[model samples]
Target chain A: MGLNLEFMLSIIPELLSAMVITLQISILAVLLGIMGGLVVGSFRVIGPKWLKMLIQLLVDYIRGTPQIVHILIIYFALPRIGIILNAYWTGVVALTIIATGYEVEIVRTAIESIDKGQIEAGLAIGLLKRQILIFVLLPQAIRRIIPPLTNELTNIVKASAFLSVIAVNELTKISNKIIYETFYFFEVLILTALIYTVIITLLGMLSNFIEKRMFSTNSEANS
Target chain B: MDISFMIEIVPRLLRATWVTLQVSAISLMIGLVFGIVLGVLRVYGNRFIVWCTKGFVIVARGTPAAIQIYAAFFLLPRLGIRLPLFAVGVVALTFNTSGYQVEIVRAALESIDKGQIEAGLAIGLTRWKTMLYITLPQAVKRMMGPMTNEFANLIKASSALMLISLYELTKSGHAIIAATFKYAEVLVLVALFYFVLVQSLCKLSAYLENNVFNFGKTADPRNEFLN
Candidate 1:
């Protein structure tokens, strides 16, 4: 039989509402990722040499693996150690861990992109390291980090769908439930895929808008 | 956390890693071919072809790999086309990986100087000859590093096949945990297995990228880890 568009249309509202959970997870994970990444990433940049090596190992180990393993490990494995998390935290923890690794890369790269001469000039003018970082380095890095950071936001939203495996009732999980009932399988999947496409495309557009507004005159920021 | 459990699990995990590599390798090969065709279509095809290729890339990339895998594993059988689990895993990955690969090749192709192809044609080279002799060689050279990075990415992304109960590396870990009740320890070994696999691949690419493709260039930011 052809795709039952009637079933598909009926499920659209439920799927859209479930997207709120998906967005929630994305927001939470993105915020934690930024905060944690800034901490780990800044330490890597400015911390001692031994600390840099340790953090680098941590970053690589986390970044080297897949997010799905992290989810299974956190949700399933952690309970063996007496730390049981319900469905939601497991996804957030895994996503934040993954996103944090990426953010570390983004921050490390952004910070490095700033000219050493600028920092040296700040030092030459008798500013402290902290003051120079606040005044000179950070302003440059934040702008540079925006494009990649938003790129990570879309990643969080996308990867958050994996939470469905743990019964997190996010967008994908909710849609899967409906598909189980209706067997309007292709139609449901297409609708779900379309929702994700719209969300990601909007994020892309937002990044473009910000890029245009922030980098209208500066040529280097075009990237 | 038992030492014997970890020891016993290693072989099965290694075999599962082979399965993971199999999927990634086949998909990477298929993706490389389709990705090139898609990239070429963006640059040289008619308007409808360009739109169709771009639409594929956008949809493939925008959604999560897990959802795509689920849709394929669950939705396709209803249309009277039942694929083997291995085939399903490979199809999902090949489709997903090709989208990203298309972007990489397209960027490299577009970056070629306009004058080079014109120069080739000016010297009596056919359009096809220009692509073969001039355009593709340079684009392929520049694409080596990114393509290597994407290959490692394919291996990592293959872990998502666990969602559909495909018995890859990650799913192998889950089986170990289920049988042994050593969740943290088994999963640790599983993570280590993946880490070693990914690192070795990265090092291999970095080695080739470092020695052969220097082209007198210093470290690009993306290539810094290679050196």
Candidate 2:
């Protein structure tokens, strides 16, 4: 079938509106995931043995199972348990949980990469363990964590497409709806992909720019 | 929380695990073969091939596998190309994994020292021979960890096959829970099965890394602890 520009154009506004929902879900999920990661990562490092083991098991389970499976479980199973969440919230919670697993690893690695001498120096200079972690270690670790965290954020945005399966009217879901309505599958799908490409590319460029700025400042400080 | 219901479902879930493994294993094998070729083209081919490879990787990596599976299952039939859900799942995942694997293999290839290639050439080995003998062996060694990790990722990603009704592990869990209505218990069990499988793979990869791929002897102790 030939492409239909007119049909595609008519749906652009609708798709754009849907893209806003996609953006909201992506951003909120990333924010919540980052907060969860901070707690999980910190616990992995310093929590009691049982707590650390529990957190590690949580991370493993999240990492091992697919996000799509988690989405299915949360979307389908939660309702039966009397915790009825809408599709969008279910999508957000599922994505956030998976993202937190990955982010915890990233955060933990970034923290561990900080030289041991710095932590020892802070401790020797009268800082408590918590004080050193908050003041000296995390500041340095956060700088290192930014790049991977941004990559994870971009990944979370792409992963939001899975929400379409559960009937979230995100960009991909709207495109599916348009395709069903107009039967112009290729044209509409291509347009949706182009829009996603542009957003993800811009996100990648912004992260690279931030990385450059941070590294330059880091080098200046070292010098 | 009815333990007996879960106990009864164990046999069914075990049968489903076989399907999940079949899907993951078949796709991983196919993807690795395709990925190596794509990686070679990516590293050595002309600009047009490079761009095409990059486009393949970007589209696959930048989108969810569910959409790709949907496109494969729903859109392909509309274009007069019909396939079973199992075939569609395998093809879609092969395409997906090859995208990521190309990058991994390309990096592995590039990580080999330039001087090694030169030494091979000095011995009168042809370009192809040098790549086959010297470059590929080193690349394979360096690639073991990443390849194993990707394999683990593919196993998890195969869960997306449920969208097309493939009756894999997750789908089987959904079926069991649908009947028994024990949502949390069933899902937690499903998650446990996945955890055990993936954690074992991770530990296996770590063992391979330490024993076989220990070319870089300056290993970090923390990594050992984490493993």
Query: Backbone clashes in each candidate structure, one number apiece?
Result: 0, 0
Evaluated at residue A204, the lDDT of candidate 2 is 81
lDDT of 2 by residue, A16-131 (tens): 89889998998898889989888788767766678777877778788888777788777876677688887889888888888898899887887777777777888789987677
Superposition TM-score, candidate 1 onto the true structure = 0.94
Output the number of the lDDT-best candidate.
1
lDDT of 1 by residue, B1-227 (tens): 58987888788888999999999999999999998988988877889999999999999899989788988787668768889999999989998999999999899988999999999999999987898789989999878878878878888889889888899999888877778777878888888888888777777667667677775654543322100
Task: For residue A39, give model 2's deviation from the true position in Å.
Answer: 2.5
| Cα lDDT, model 1, residue B163 | 81
Q: What share of the true interface contacts does each candidate keep?
A: 0.66, 0.47
Overall lDDT per candidate, in order of appearance: 0.83, 0.82
lDDT of 2 by residue, B1-227 (tens): 77887787888888888888888889989998988889988887799999999988888777667667767776778789888888888988887899889999999999999999999999999988898899988898878888888888988888878777899998888777778777877887787787787888888787788887675564442342211
Question: How does candidate 2 fare on TM-score?
Answer: 0.92
Give the CA lDDT, 0 to 100, for residue B163 in model 2: 74
